[model samples]
Target: MCGTIDLYYALTNKEEAKGILPNLRFVKETNRRDLHDYIMWHNINHLTKFLSKKYEDAYTPVLKVNNRENDNDLIWKKCLKMIPDFLQIPLSSLYLRYNIDPRDKIRVEEMADIIRDTYVKSFRQNAWMDEITKNNSIYKVHDMKFKIGYPQYILDPTEVDKDYEGKMEELPSHICYNQPSMGKRNRAYLFGAIGSIISYFISHSFNHPNREFKRNGVWESWLSNKSLEESFKELQNCYRDQYSKYWINDQQVDGIETIDANIADNSGIFMALQALKNRRDMNNVRYTSNSNITEDQLFFLAYAQARCSNETVTPPPTSPYKYRVNGVVSNLKEFSDAFSCSRGDPMNPPKKCTYWDF
Candidate 1:
């Protein structure tokens, strides 16, 4: 009886959810009637269109209104994307073998260790937190588990199919944008890019890096000390004020609104730079730049390149991509040194804000 009632409520909520969904994939300005028709046609023809543009008329306007840079993908690319729904593991495995080097697992694990060490060092040097809090932070990093890559067993399709419904697949979250092509990037940039992404995803998972809350089991925090709380707030204000002043397309960034992403952005860059510095490969010239560019310069360039885009989401919780690059780079003196900008220049302002001052 309860299961039947639960099913009835589930169906009812799903029907009610239509009031909110509105078939708006990427934009709100699309015509409702047009979208409704598109959905009806799409339900019938989406698969057939991959073989041939059988319903281009129904989909073209949605792309145009969404301001998509390219309205059409290659036939194979579309098919490849669509096939994942039916053949996820096999297709992903094939893509991994073809594009992602198996050795990237080693790269990711090594980078994760480097970032963890960097975090510990930063905690040790942190002048704001009391030793108690600082020690707890260090302990957390020490105990944190870093899972780097997919399981080797996944390569066996027969084993996967036996319990597919119960298993959660580990996959690359942002293969194209986050992991920039290694050949196009200098070593410093490559390390920075990979290290940044490693820390970026990790940061989002176990958030509030600055706060501690374990009171027992060898790791605990009150998070109630007035002085430490003040220090934490000061750290937040530093990034918040810095971002609040940045204007994009006449809209001032809502620093308070985007504080988490802003903090993650700064922390990612900091951790990545630290990881690069922590490596034994640092010969003061990690990458030989052909165009008189320094290694550190290449690192920042790669970070910016991966993030370079003009698109901004409506009611952005993060700054625009341009500002994300600008805001992060401007906070670090190393960025100014990397590019050799004058101190008073826009990119190298005299004042900067930092947290965990590594």
Candidate 2:
């Protein structure tokens, strides 16, 4: 059944892939290099957005506040204020290596798992979101799936082959060289980092059963108590609760769309904190803040501060990955306090911050 469904989906998706190939050929013939890059960029963007949206829906409220107030502005502003520590590039060399390491996929999957554990645990600890919301958020995350590295399996290789027809036959000789570096330090660093991330992930898996039980165990009982007909009605209502409003025109304001993955990470954490705060308030949990700011604003500012870094991209601002990760995280007060950011020079939010107090 799984194989048949996969095959059917593959065939259906291939038509769209093939349709784009002729345009790639056109770009090649026209000598328009930018067009080729644009196509590749959008193709990657679509995949990222699709995956992010799929997972994000279960965790976040779909309140799209910001046509005028986008997250990019906040991210960039925070990036500009970042220090050096949070912005350090421990894996720079490995990332730049671009060599086909056999363990690359395994390493990436491990990284995803590590990130999920850290962030999802934080989600559970948030003081703002309510019990039901926290439970739902955690449930969504505990059941969350990971698809690290590229979805090459989803790529129709035949369609890719069709695009390569009559293209350059001679591969770059420089890339084909079979030389292996003998530097032990560099080699150890690369392997060690990958191993460390994997170790963390493997250790976290042991705790998964408890997390799953907490979410599913109670919810399943409530859901199972109803008659079949009543259960179906509740299920239908739940679907409407989440997605029915998305179809209504003018439902939400405009927001910033960014190529930066870190922005989404920042926003996700911010919202989780907000939800935590709401939860805490409802539960009469005592909390104090010296910042004189709403948890919503502080959550966003924390996200912005996360992007703070001392590193600046030369004129054109290359390396969105580095900028998003190091720059943003460096600016947060929470991060700074944990890492000890100096007084009177904390991170700043965007000039036109669209405060999503939702």
**Steric clashes per prediction:** 4, 32
The residue-by-residue lDDT of candidate 1 on 153-250, one tens digit each, is 55567655643666655543323222434455455766666778777764553245433444233333434378887777788888888888888778
CA lDDT scores, all candidates in order: 0.68, 0.38
Q: Report the C-alpha lDDT of model 2 over 51-85, residue by residue, as the tens digit.
A: 44355453233235423222333445645544222
Tell me, by lDDT, which candidate is best: 1
TM-score of 2: 0.29
TM-score to true structure, per model: 0.69, 0.29
Task: Name the lDDT value of residue 241 in candidate 2.
Answer: 31
Worst 10 residues of 2 by lDDT: 252-261
Model 1 off-target regions past 4 Å? 1-82, 161-185, 204-224, 280-286, 312-314
> Lowest lDDT 10-mer window, candidate 1?
2-11
For candidate 1, report its TM-score: 0.69
